[model samples]
Target: MTNPYKSYLSIGEKLDKSKFILATFHLQSENQPPARNASASDAGGFDQTAGGVAAESSVGTWTDVSLQEKILWENLRGRVVELDEKASIIRIAYPLELFEPGNIPQFLSSIAGNVFGLSEVSALRLMDIELPEVYVRSFPGPFLGIDGIRKITGISDRPFLGSIIKPKLGLSAQEHIAASMEVYDSGIDLVKDDENLTSQTFNNFYTRVDEGTKRMKEAGYLKEGRQKIYAYNITASYEEMLKRAEYVVDRGGNCLMMDVLTAGFASVCGIRNRNFGKIIHAHRAMHAAFTRSKQYGISMLVIAKLARLAGVDSLHTGLLPAVFTRDTCLTW
Candidate 1:
């Protein structure tokens, strides 16, 4: 029988079906052949002719296919649009019906699952995605965007100045509070806990938020009507993360920070749904493992987009080289 994917040979045909995801895959030389077949099967590679009378009677024609089989095949398969041997890139059009609107976990599993483990692929990266308008509109993105952040921090003319607390782990709760107050007094607009700085033994999350905000108010920072944002790192288990965020909000904290990569995009989206009325600062703590390689893993740009879609107010983009290592720079 004719290849089912042959029906969607042109860009116009793919575009006509509005609900679909456009995914780009990078394939290494060792697995190119199988990767091609796997990608074809990933979306719709099932042999309609196998174990049936249609296999023997209409082996070379598409006419014998039933309407139900055609519809099912189309819904299950991803259409291959471009495959470049020299450059090693494969672009596939995944049906929008394959994903559920507003569900990131399911979306990830559909577009990003299992393909990496295929024996044919030595390395595979999900470089980019072209999400349809309906899918894009289904999620509530950053509530506080760049303009909103600028308005909240009262810094519109230039870049907002911020710093991470040094010696990331050992500081006591009081020490953390002192350092934050000093930064706020020094005219820094924001201060954030380092990505690894969670509820450590010495620097408890609640104590830091409680004393830190108190010190900010006492420093006359709030008295002058200028807001100084303290992004308390709330990266923990799903339940613990929510509790930490709630604690920050209850104590009048202005911002919440999370290691978006380690905590998972779903966690960030969950936090956004809480409507806590605080800025969400996203730290790409462990993104390098999946984003550093040029020929393997995803890109930081895609990660940033996902974070924004998950509703982060401010995302670390590696603008400051001094803050990130050489390896981290590669991911950015």
Candidate 2:
């Protein structure tokens, strides 16, 4: 009996770095004995499970394909470039043509989506991904990057201090303003809406922007001419986010905070591309659900990279750092 998806395994294939993405996954197999129907030479545990990942993620189904389908699969399937048995790591080289350029959501949906649910592996994590230079540059990253943030706050050579308006909820819009003003008066440089506080009746979105922005201006101008950032949360439906952003700009707010995970990457990109002259701050509120486990789901580093590609200026800490680069592997 021949292996059904053996063609997906190409152990020593040399990929064009520019035309492919290298993804590293921490893989685990059920490690059971070979089925009775398998060939006598079958090492039907880890190798087959690893190959299943490439097949499912790319083009192959569990069932065998016809000769005609094999011709089409030749160029489309993700090729397993390296598999380490002891360390339980598999590296796959995926063709750039397999992904939609400049679309993070679709790219993730393809490689990181369906493969996680497969029964062959009990534990899996999307440990790391290396991007081609062209793919990295395809999206407009960071509307107001580090220099812009430094320029905004008039701070150099030191970290800017900030806080959230706590008693995170049940604070009326006016009370929320008072609490934020206290933080600003104490010389904190940034204040943001907590991730869960958005558009609630007790603290309505419009009032928060209208009054909060006014108070920020007073606090900023009066306190040694320092600029205070009101990173107002605009996480909502895409259309609603735009509407809220307009309201923030109209109210003279200098920054916007988004629960990027909750807002969705596409919406984050939508807000960034609008370029309403405000810095975008990312809050990964529910990221732990996807990032905490060392053996499951996507890594926080991957999330940060996606956030940067989606155009966030500053991100929540655990947490927060710039995207992974070639030098990053050295540090890891």
Pairs in clash, predicted candidate 1:
43-76, 43-77, 43-78, 44-77
Model 1 misplaced stretches (Cα beyond 4 Å): 1-14, 31-68, 223-225, 319-327, 330-332
Candidate topping lDDT:
2
Report the lDDT of model 2 for residue 205.
Answer: 95
Global fold similarity of model 2 (TM-score) = 0.90
Q: Model 1 — which ten-residue stretch has the worst lDDT? A: 49-58
| Candidates' C-alpha lDDT | 0.71, 0.81
Q: Which of the numbered candidates is closest to the native, going by highest TM-score? A: 2
Q: How far in Å is the alpha carbon of 188 misplaced in model 1? A: 1.4
Per-residue alpha-carbon lDDT of candidate 1 for residues 144-257, written as tens digits (9 for 90 to 100): 788877776677889888887788889999997788788877888889999899998898888888898788777755432367888999999999999999998887778899
RMSD (Å) of each candidate, 1 decimal: 6.6, 4.4
Candidate 2 colliding pairs = none
